[model samples]
Target chain A: MSTFIQQLANGVSLGSIYALIALGYTMVFGVLKLINFAHSDVMMVGAYVAFFVATGLNAGPDPSIASALITFLAAMAGAAALGIAIERLVYRPLRSASRLSLLIAAMGMSLLLEYGGQVVFGPQHRRVPDVITDERIVLGDLNLTVHKLIILGVSVVLMLGLHFFVNKTRTGTAMRAVSQNVDAAKLMGVNTDFIIGLTFAIGSALAGAAGLLVAFHQQGDIDPLMGVYPGLKAFVAAVLGGIGSIYGAMLGGLLIGVAETFVAAYLPSSFRDTITFSILILVLLVRPAGLLGKFKPEKV
Target chain B: MRGAAIKLGFLVVLVGAAIGIDFALREIFNPHWLRLIELAGIHVVIAVGLNLINGYCGQFSIGHAGFWAIGAYASGVLLTVAEQKWGTPSAVVEILLLVGGMAIAAILAGAAGLLVGIPSLRLRGDYLAIATLGFGEIIRNVIVNVDAIGGPRGYHGIPVYTNAAWCIIVAALAIWFSRNLVTSSFGRALVAVREDEVAAEAVGINTTRVKVIAFVVSAMMTGAAGALYAHLDGSLDPDTFKFTKSIEFIIMITVGGLGSITGAVFGAIVLTLLPELLREIHPTLSEYRMVIYSALLIVIVLVRPKGLLGNRELSPSAGIAWLRRKFGKGTA
Candidate 1:
């Protein structure tokens, strides 16, 4: 029972990170209908930014709350800038192009960032400065680490903030309108480009936050290609929860995280990565529309 | 009848020329480039095969590497066993056994294609792309886990049976096979499916059958190419056949021109030679080669949209017209 509870806690922490990243993927796919393959790379960028900010500031593992906040905000700002730049420079011009063209361009941006990041960042493992000193917190049979609790807590706060922003804010409403019907939203005097850019910004900020959280939790284990697996798994999570649905992405992330954790605990650990792709194939075969996604009618 | 005779003469000349070049590479050229040329020929087979599904049929499957891995492992395992039983038979017997191994590779790959193609029947566009991507990853993982094939450490000790001659023959056959398929009535059905699946079905085209057959054929060609690659490399590392390699094939078809056989050939050759060409420029340049490669992909899609050759095949008159369009502003 204790093992199961601890595993569950670990699963939720991991799932929260996935959920944060998946939300960004879901939003980008919602507005543009492109996979935005570079979105995951933005998570990498976010992690790197935080690493530079945190470690460059001090060599100590633990930093005060102010330094941690500064690091987090800097990563968020950096990722948002990158997100908008990619959307405006790489994706915007190809908006009216064929789906294949858009897909390829996204892939181009993905490759550009990955290799370019490797070039600029000098592909090597860099440790993220720990913002908080972790302590063991025991509750009943559950063994919870302080960083893990912080991850879960921070993720919930950001998720709630995003939910409220999307549901209530005027700009967020414009984003929804554009997603529903771009032309209609344009005619209604909504600045479509600005909204799209804002969507990218907000989504990327969340990913940045997730990146920092994972960094702190993993004791500064960050690298250039670190985002590839999480990025892909988050994508699979987005797809599993009807892609355009925000809550669906969150739910899907949690489910995949828990499932992966349970599988690893019961089965050989090598199967951990394989389980994500297997679930992807199964979901695609069973429900391409996803759990919460409404089936779209094919236009003749 | 006279035209038929001329066409037959052209094909014979083409094969003879290919064989002549192969022998030249064997006897004359620096042996270093011989390896590159052989690898280029192998990629040509893969590019043509991929074009059958992605370009001609209009399906967006990017799992070419999965079939390539299958073919490599199949060939590697078979050749290893065969060598254990009969150590390096006569040259003629060796070629025959290699051909036999290639056939087995193709069959295994084709079966995998069939399994992947079934889900494709129910999906289209990006969904299909994701499915194929998943299939490729699954194949890689399965191979990584299975220990009899040496698992993740990769299979070694395979002899070098693939050479310039074998590569040329395989590439030539693949080029001709795809060219014929693209011009045939069945090929038109594939184009129809790509254009509009509903319309194709409405016109009595069995879109599913066309998709499945195209996928199977594409897989077989990639598998054969994989066999060549395995023998050339003399060892097979499972990680070498990852998503990146598959994307390279996609880049070839996209850069060449989807749905154009000649375009597939052009893409395969240019892309295969691109890194080699870049290496001559500088070592650092080669490191940033993918950056330039991907940037070109974006630029080409933005400029031509259709591709370098677009839907048009490379012919003398067509080439002249294209040059004129590029250079001649309005008619003189």
Candidate 2:
């Protein structure tokens, strides 16, 4: 019973990272209607940036909150820059092109980042410096670590901030408008391009934070290709929650993370991924538009 | 009757040419070059199969590697079982075994395709792509857990039945089959569906049935290619069928030009050889080969969104026609 609660805690911590990444995928898919396969690679880039910053600052053997904050900011900024660059360069030119073209372009961008990362980062797995202290909190049978607490706290705060921003801010309103109808938004005097770029920036910034959190979770075992699996599962989370629904992305991520954790605990560890995917298929089967997504019939 | 005779004669010439080249290459070129050629042929089969679904049917699938892996393991297991049952059979038995293995691979892989396709084909475009991707990963994970087929250690000791003759002949047959398929009425229906699904449905075309057929056939072709790949490599690893490998095939068709059979073949050949060419230029340069290819992909998408060939054939006749048109000498 204690183990169950412990597993639940572990799952939520993992799920938080997935939620952050899924937010990026859902948002990009919302506005641009493009998958942005490079989103994962962007997360990878953020992690690498954080790695460099943490290492360069010599955050030292001891964990410091200031250093971690600095590292997070640096990575998020770098990732935001990259996200905007990808949209401006790769996606912008093909705005009027077919969805297939956009998808392929996005894939190309993904491969470019992955392989280019290999070339730039030299394919070596770099150990991330400890920016957070290794402290654990025990509550009766349940044990929680400082790292896990930080992950949950940061994720919740960020999500709430995003919620407020999207609901209250002008830019966020423009983003919502563009996603609802790009041409209509343009007619209403919104800079559709700027909104889309900003969407990428915000999404990518979230992915960047997810990257650092994930690095922290794994004790800084970072690599160029580290983003592939997490990225894939996150994309699945985005889809599972309903691609265009931000709240759905969060819920789906947490659901998948918890389900995966339970499966790993109860079933053969190899079945963890298989079970997670099966759940996705089943959910998709029942709810085609996803749990939170509203289905709009195609206009003939 | 005259046309039939000419077509028959052409097939004979093509097969003969393939066999002759296989033998001649064995004598002329080293085994390394021969392997590369064989690998390119395998990619050609895969790319064409993928094109049938993605290009013609307009359904996106990045899980083709799953079907390919299924075919490979099917054939590998079949041959392994045969060897255990009958020790070192004669030449006739060897030929039979190879044919039987490929047939089994096709059937099993096709069934697997049907299983995945039926459920997922209901989804549109990007959703379908994601579902298939998930299915592919599930397949890989399943393969790893099953211990009878070597699991994560990889299935080894598979006999090498694939030669240059087999590669060329199978690739030619696959391309021929796909060409015929795309040119037929069903092919027209597929193209129509790709152009507009709602209109196709409105026109009384069963979009679902057409899509399922395309998906199954494509899966079968990919499976056959996987069988060939297994024999050629003499080993099967689940890792080889990862999602990234599926992306590689997508790159091929997209680079060559989707919906163009000749483009698939051309793209497969160029991509397979590009790394080798880079290595020849500089051993270290091969490390940057994927970076170059990906950059090229982006450039192609930005400059010429329709790809290099853009659904056009690049056959000898077409080439000659193009040349004549360019020179303003023939037909005009």
Candidate 3:
């Protein structure tokens, strides 16, 4: 029972990270109908930015709460700026092309970010400074790390914040309007570009937060290739939940995380990735629109 | 009469120049030029095969490397295990085994494609992209876990059978096959399906069949390239056929031009050569080569979204004729 609970906790923690990054992917897809393949690298950029900031300030493994907060904000801001720049420079120009063209371009941008990051940061892993170092709390045989609790708590809060922002804000409504029908949204005088850019910024900020949380949880080891697997897993979560549905991405992330953890525990570790991807393929085959996705027939 | 003479003269001069360059490279370089030619040939095969599905049929498949891996392993296993276990096979027997290996790989990869394609064909653009991407990942993972094929350590000790001559022959065969395919009735149906699936279906064209056929054929061709790659490298590693390699193949097709066979060859050659030239400049730049390559791809797509050739075939005859008119019989 304790093993099950521990697995559950690990799944949720990993799922939360996947959910946060998946939100960015689903949001970009929802609004622009383009899969930003570089979004994973964007998350990597966020983690690295936070790493640099924490190290620059001499913020050791255990930093003051205020310093941690300041470092996170600075890192998120840098990530947001990078996201905005990529959108404006690389993707914005190809807005009118076929989806295939955009997909290829996004892939190229992904490679650019990954290799560029490698070149700049060097192709080595950098340890992230641990901000939270409290030990685990044992409750009868279920020992839960304080860092896990913090990650879960912060992730839930951020998710709720995103929900409120997308559902309640004027810009959020405009974003919904554009996603529903860009031509109709444009006809109604909504600035499509502004909404798209805002969506990218918000999505990337969430990725940044997730990145920081992951760094803190993992004790701050960062690598140029760190984002690739997580990014792919997040994408899987996004698709499994429903590609353009925000809530669906969250649910998908948790489910996948749980599924992966259980499989790893029960099955051979070698088969973990294979099992996860197999689940993705099976889910896609069964429901092309995904668990929460709606299907719209292709327009001639 | 003058035009005809000029065209003939230009052809002679062009052939002379090509031979001259080939001989010069043989003398100056340490067999590196041959290797480059082989690389270009392999890429041409991969790119052209991808063009059939992604370019002509308008299906977005980023999993070409998965099929490539399948082919490489199939060929590698045959060359290493089968020959030793059975007998000292003759040259003819070995050749037949290699071809059989390629066929089996194509069949296996094609089956995998069908598994992914049948249900997901109903999904549009980005969704299909995700499905294919997932399939690619699944293939990689499966290869990693399966111990029979040496798992992640990869298969080695395969006899090195891929040479410049073999690469050129395979490339020539691929190009010829694709050219014939795109001009046939079946090819027109593929084009129709690409243009508008609904309309094509209404007109009695089996869109699903066309899609499946194109996808399977494309997978097979990519598998052939993988077979060649395995032989050339004398070993096969799963990491070499990752998602990144798939993306590189996609870049070749996109930067070359979609729906153009000639564009595939041109793009593959130029992109392959550009990196090789860069590598010659500085070894460190080789690590940063993908960054530079991708940046150039982005810039090119932004500036000319339709690609360099954009559905146009290279007209060697026309080029020769123009050159002859300018150079006045090539001073002959």
Candidate 4:
């Protein structure tokens, strides 16, 4: 029972991280209807930025709240800038082109970032600072870590802030409008390009924060290829939650995280991924719209 | 009479070139360069076959590697098992076994393609892409787990029977098949579905059937390529057929010209050789090779969007037309 609770807590932490990344995928897919394959790379870029800022600023071995905030904001900004740049330079011109072109372009961007990042950053893992001090807390049967708690707290805050902004802000409303109907939104005088850029920026910023948090979780180690697996799984989460649904992305992320945790703990670790994918395939065969997604029939 | 004579002359020249080239590859060219050329031909088979599904059929199937993996392992295991039972067969017997091996590989890969295609019939675009990707990953996972074929230790000791001649023949056959396929009515149906699925369906074209056929054909071709690849290396590792390899094929068809066989051929040859060229230019520069290719990919998609050949074919007629305008009294 204690082990179960411990595993459950671990699952929640991993799920929260997945949710942060999935939110980025869901939002970008929501607006552009294009999967930003490079979104996870933005996470790596973010982690790197934070690493540089922390080390460069002479934060020393001990990182306080102020230094952590500095690293966090710097990473977010760097990632946001990257996401916006990719959109403007690579993807914007192909907006009117076929989805295939866009997808290929996105793929190219992903490759460029991965390989270019290797060239630029060198094929080496950089040491990152832990934003929070490590502490293990045992409450009853559950084993909780300070890093996990911080991650959960930060993720919750971000998700809530996102909800508030999207539900209330004018720009966020425009984003929703464009996602719902791009042409219609354009005719209604929504700055579609600006909205799209903003979406990428915001989504990428969240991913960057997730990156730092992840690095912290992993004991201050980050690399260029670190984002690929989590990024792909997050993408799977986004799809499982319904591509265009924010809440669904979060739900899907948590569900996958929990399920993966349980599978790894109770079953052979190798079967974990196979079973996860099989379940996804099976569930998708039944509910193509995903669990929380409604079937929106197109006017063909 | 003149056309028949010209066709005969062309056939003779083609046969002569094949015979001469095989000898030249064996006796003159370095084995290292020959290996590169052989690998390039195998890639051509893969790229062209993938174009049949991705370019012409208008489906985004990225699981070509999965099919390739199946065919390779199938033939590799078959030959390994057979060799144990009956030592190394005679040259003639070996050739026959090779043909039989390719056939079984094709059949099994085509069957797997059919299974993956059913899901593709319903899933559109990226969903199909992911599903096929899942299928590929599943295959790799299964291969790694199965110890019968040496598992992750890598399958080895298969005879290296795949020569430049075999690769060239198969590559030529693949090109021939795709060329004829594109000009046929069935080919037009694929283009129709690509352009507009609803319109194609309304025109009484069975989109599902067309897609399935394309998938099966592509899968079979990929399988043959895999068999050829395995025989070339005389070994197999599940890692070789990863999603990264699938992406490489995608890059090929996209670069050459989607839906264009000639473009795929050109793309395959250019991509295969470009890295080598870069390596020769400078070792340090080679590290930037993928970066350049990826950047070019981005640039092409952004600037041209239609790719090198687009829907256009590179035919002798095009050259003839250009020459006619240049000097045959129709110029400006």
Q: Pick the DockQ winner.
A: 2
Task: Indicate the residue-level lDDT of A265 in model 4.
Answer: 96
User: Clash pairs of candidate 2?
Assistant: none
Q: Model 1, A178-222: lDDT tens per residue?
A: 888889999999999999999999999988888888786678788
Q: TM-score, each model?
A: 0.94, 0.97, 0.92, 0.95
Is 1 or 4 the stronger prediction by lDDT?
Answer: 1
Native-interface RMSD of candidate 4: 1.7
Candidate 2: where are CA atoms >4 Å away? B1-11, B329-332
Candidate 2: deviation at residue B56, Å? 1.4
Give the per-residue lDDT of model 4 (tens digit) for A1-300.
889888888888888888999999999988988988899889999989988898887665775888878888999999999999998988888888999999889888988888888998888988786655778988988888888898889889999999999999998899899889999999999999999999999999999999988887787888988888788778778878888899988998898888889999998777666765665665557776677776675345
Off by over 4 Å in 3: B1-31, B318-332
What is the lDDT for B119 in model 1? 75
Better of 1 and 2 by DockQ: 2
Candidates sorted by DockQ, best first: 2, 3, 1, 4
Cα lDDT tens digits for candidate 3, B192-247: 98888889989999888888889888988988888888878788888998999898
Interface RMSD after interface superposition, each candidate: 1.4, 1.3, 1.4, 1.7
If you superpose only chain B onto the true chain B, what TM-score does each candidate give? 0.91, 0.95, 0.85, 0.93
Candidates' C-alpha lDDT: 0.86, 0.90, 0.83, 0.86
Off by over 4 Å in 1: A59-62, B1-17, B320-332
